[model samples]
Structures are given as structure tokens and as C-alpha cells.
Target: MALAQYARLGVISRSAPGLVLARPLLAAVPRSTTTSVLRSLASSARAGRFASSRREPGMVPVGRRTRELPVNTIIKFVPQQEAWVVERMGKFDRILEPGLAFLVPVLDQVKYVQSLKEVAIEIPTQSAITQDNVTLELDGVLYYRVVDPYKASYGVENAEFSVAQLAQTTMRAEIGQMTLDRTLAERNQLNINIVESINTAAHDWGIRCLRYEIRDIHPPENVVQAMHSQVSAERSKRAQILESEGARQAAINVAEGHKQATILASEAVKTERINEALGAAEAILAHARATAQGIEKVAASISDSPNGHDAVSLTVAEKYVDAFGNLAKQGTTVIVPTDVNNVGSMVAQALAVYKNIGQARETPTALPKDSRKQAILDTLVPQQDTPPARK
Candidate 1:
């Protein structure tokens, strides 16, 4: 198996005498992989050079080395999500992708392997003065990714520490620009502004600012009290406004109801008045019709009666007796007939006038009864003055 393996990997000699090399190894691997391999081997060869680099990563063993160094170097294996920065004589050379790479020994160096994954870093709590001159203690977290390995390794001493400090200073500056209320109220805007500010400066450092989040913001006791009071007052004002609106709506409803009731009541009154007027008008029309009918009946009877004269004379005498009787009963001073004998003459004149009216219409009726005439005569007769027999 050893012979077959040796045959498969044919070995050759370099330009130097007695120096055997496996140039086939570098030929079989890619330039990047071969370069990385050579750089790591060179880093390990420089006795004290790689000693301090022990803290750095990417020291994995790939192949066995002979007692004599080879002209071509073995390739290094790079894992996923990792990068290796190569420096030629301590100067920036190239970034090694995840693969097998070889380099010139003693000339190239594998500085370190950098992680391209995102990391979350916590920013310590810091005291800052707002634009309103209010002092507040605040803390947050930051997420970042390393985009460029070369700049990350050589641009800054400590990327994590430098990023943290930059975030702190930028946060303070941003907080200083705004008032305390804006900072506390607009957290999203604050985070966006902080991310923007940090990203602007972090591009040179090969660090990408992903996102930032505010964790805690502690205000002074006095400020907290004032905020609480302001909130309470706002709540109270809203409640009062809502209550007033409710009351106003109720009042409008009540007033509308009253107006409707008044309209209905007035309508009823108007209807009643119209009904009463209609009833009165009907009564007056009936009364006028009744009066006309009564007058017509009396006139017809007078024209049909042949003895209408005697009946009229009897009616006049009876009416005169009734009047004299009522006057004698009610008044202390009585109105005597001008002459007691004149009553008979007045009734006789009434009889003659009615007789002439009946003859003209050609109607004859029976005379009144003899008793009624005798009673009328007796009522009209006055007793002669009686002499007083004794004082």
C-alpha cells in the first residue's frame, strides 16, 4: 500500500541538490487552497512568529511534513462560515474562501480565521443628557456581521470593543440631539437612527450593523412622577370629554322628544277646536232651519183657519192676563192697563185684523171656546172702588 501510495503521488527534486519535493501536491490542489496551506505552514515554521498566534484560530493539522522542507506547500482546509486572511510580509494580501489553499512558505502568513456569522452584543448602561437637559440612564443591544476579513483584522485593534465604544458615543450624540420625550416615545426611530449612525462609521471597520434594540431606559424620580401626572391628566381630560359628549347627546334626545310631544299636543288641540267649531255651526244651521219650519207651520195654520180672528183674540187676552199676573207678583209698583175697558177693545181690534187676513187667504176655521173668551173678559174687568166701612 505504501508503494502504491508513493507511486500515485510522484515525488520530484527541486533546483537545490539533495532537496526532494512533492510539487505534485500543490499541482493537484487549487491555487487558493495551496496558498492557504503554505501560509499556515510558514506561520508554524517561524518559531516565535506563530507562538503569539496560538490565540488565533485555524491551526488544524492537514498533512505530514518531511525532515526537509518542500518546494511546494500542502493545502489548508477551511471550514464553512469561516475566512482566512493572508498577509505577505505583514501586508494585506488576499482573503481565503472556504476551501483548500497553499502559499509560499516563509513569505506568506495566515493571520487568523474570522467568523462571518452574526453576533449579538450588549451595550452597557450609559448616562446621557437629552436635548431638554434631562439626564437618563439607558442600555441596549447590537447585532452585527463581519463582511470583510482583511479590514476587520487590520483596520481596528479590537472590533467588538471598538464597535461597542462607537455605539455608545453615537447613542450619546443622538440622544443629545433630541429631547427626552422624543427619545422615550419614539423607540423605533431611535433604534433606526442609532443603527444608521453606527453603520456609517462601521463600514470602514468591515463590520455590518444589523439592528439595534433599546433594553432599558431609567429616568429620574422627578421625571417619572411628572410623566405619570401628565398621563393621568390626559386620561382625565379624555374621560371628561366623553362624558360631556354623552350628556350632550342625551340633552338633544330629550329636546327632540319634547318637541315631538308639543307638536302632537298642538295638533290635537287644533283638531278639537275644529271639531267644536263644526258642531257649533251645525247647531246654528239646525236652529235656523227649526225657526223657519216653525214660522211656516204657524203661517199655514193661520191661513187655513176661518175663525183665526177669534183664536187670535183669545191668545192676546190670555197673554195680557199672564203678563199682568207676573208683574203683580214680582213688582211692588204695577203697571195698570191705561183703561180696564181698553183691554176688550184691544182684543176686538186684534180679532178684526185676523178676520180680514183669513178672508183674503180664503180659509175658514172654528172660533175659540166660549169659556176661554169668558175667562179673558173676566181677567180684563176691574172691580169698582169699594168704600171703607171702618177706619
Candidate 2:
């Protein structure tokens, strides 16, 4: 019933045989008035098996007939070429050249002609095996251009889909031949190899695979985690080594500083000792020089005196008394000359000794005051007496 309505409305072309019902009454129709009559016949044919294929612009379909029909005659049937152009009018009509065209009407229709420019294909997610037999998920994008319109439209059912399959196959093959390390290190080479291989296989389909890119690589979760841990461990090891080296250097510096300080301290001690020894030697020399000067002064005074005999007696007696006093103070026992045994004798002996010493200097002794020695010495000194007897 729908087909009958489409036929009445002239929606489908009736050019192909067995597509619509044939009417003998419309055979004798003239071309100028035949459309209205065909429309009436289509209204009657709607309830029958005469279905309309499609309606075309500037062209009409003729009903299926047992007899051969001439071209260019008006009928309910559409020509194969006109129907072909009409079916695809919505897709390529703007680019298609306007002229006579043909199709099989319901049996054949025109498909859209895609542009020949570069088209991007979003690669589907895929898995590939590495040389180590590790599976990886990868994704990418593809760039392609159509080289031939006819071949691209007819040669393959889907040129983009065919290129994608080729890309996936080539990528898998390349990846399987290489280890994971090589695959990651030589990604540019991998991309070029896949592109070339895909381009070679896609020539028949009128597609030129210009470039293939492997964008992101997804390794196994365990492998990624292992790599992360390895990196962390390496960093930690380096840090510890550096810290140890720094500590070792610090210790070395401290030891060296202590050694230097000890050497300096020892040098200071040696310098102080030398200075002290020099000072002590100087002090001893100064004391010896002062003592010698004192001795020279005393000797000169004694020599210049006129009564040198008396001066010698007094100085000798004072020295003797001082020695005795020192000895008595330092010792438990003291010895002195016995006055009862030798006082007169010792005094006379001292006077005689003094006389002799004075004669050597041609001087005389001064008698002690309030002593008998003054009168005695005055009486005995200048008398020219008889010759001294030898005794």
C-alpha cells in the first residue's frame, strides 16, 4: 500500500523492469499529455504490485513494459543514468557536473563521493606485543589523502577503516619485532615504518597514508610501578652517598685543624722557654758585673789611704767578726781565739805585722784612741839606737 502511494506521487523511478506494473492503455499515449494519464494509471496501479522506485528531477520514470521503449519519451519510467544522479542528488549534486546520467533506479543507487583532501582518522584503541612478549595498549592519529575519486568511492567499502586496520597490523608487527626499550627509544622510526607500510598497502584503495603517529604508550601497571620505584631508589642511593662524602670531608677538616693547632702550641712553648733562658743568663751576667765593680772600688780606697796599716787592720777585723757571726748563726758550735792565752801576744803580733806592711808603703799605723799603743809607738819610732843585735 505504501508502494502504491509512492507510485501515485511519482516518488520512485519505474525504469527497471519488474519494478512496477505495466499498463497497455498508456501505450498509445502522446508524450505531451502522457504524464496526467500516467498519473491516473498510477492511482489505479497503486493497489497493484506496481511500486514506484524514486522520483527524479527533470526526468520521469516509465512503467515496466513487455515491449521495448524508445529513449526520451515521456513515461512513468526513469532512465538508469538519470536515476543514478537523482538518488545521490542530496550528496554530490553541487559538485557533480550537470548532464545526462544513469542508474539501475531501485536496483542501483549512487553513493557519496568523499573529498580528496587530508582527513584525520581517530585510531581505535589497540594492543600490541613487544619482543619480550609484553602487551601494551596504544593509541594514535592518522593523516591521509584520497588520490583517486573513483577508486576511493568504489574500490573499498571504507577507505578510512581499511587504512586503520593496516596501520594497526603494521604497528603490531613492528612492535613485536622490537623490545620495549627499542620501541620507546626509537619511536620516530616506528612511526615512519608504520606509515610507509600502510601507504604501500593502501595504494589500491586510492589512499595515501602520509603520516602515522604513535602518540601515547601505556605499559603494564606493574612495569610502570617498577620503573617508578627504581628511579626513587636510585635517587635515594645518590643522596646517601653524597651525605657520607660530606661527613667524611668534615671530619678530615676537623682533624687537620687540630693537628695544626698542636704544632702552633708546641712552637709557642719552645719560644717561651728560649726567652726565659735568655733572661736568666742576662740577670746572672749583670749580678757578676755589679760585684766586680764593688770589689774594684774597695781596693782603690784602701791603696790611696796614708794609714794603710790601720785601714787593713780594721777591714780584716770587720771581715773576721762578720764571718764569725755568720758561722755562729748557722752552726751549733763556734770557735774563737782564746783571749787569756794570746790577747797581748796577738796584739803585739798584729802591731808588728802592721809595722812591716806600713814600711812597704813607707807609712805608719794610727794608734787606737785611749790605748797605750799611741804613746808607745811615739816613743819607739824615731830613736837612733845602737845596732840591732842578731837574735
Evaluate residue 227 in candidate 2 and report its C-alpha lDDT on the 0 to 100 scale.
73
Measured over all alpha carbons after superposition, the RMSD of each candidate to the real structure, in angstroms, is 14.9, 17.7
lDDT tens digits, residue span 1-391, model 1: 2222422455222222122233434456576754655454444344322222121122321112112222224355666877777776668788778877787654565665677788788999999999999999999999998998878888887788899999999999999999988998898999999999999998998999899998999999999999999999999999999999999999999999999999999999999999999999999999999999998987788789998766766778887667557646854223244665666775654454344434533532333345434433444455579898996
Each prediction's whole-model lDDT (CA): 0.69, 0.61
For this target, which candidate reaches the highest lDDT against the unseen true structure?
1
* 267-340 per-residue lDDT for model 2 (tens digits): 99999999999999999899989889987887787788788767766666665556547646854233233563
Q: Please give the distance, in angstroms, between residue 7's alpha carbon in candidate 1 and its true position after superposition.
A: 36
Find the 10 residues in a row with the least total lDDT in model 2: 61-70
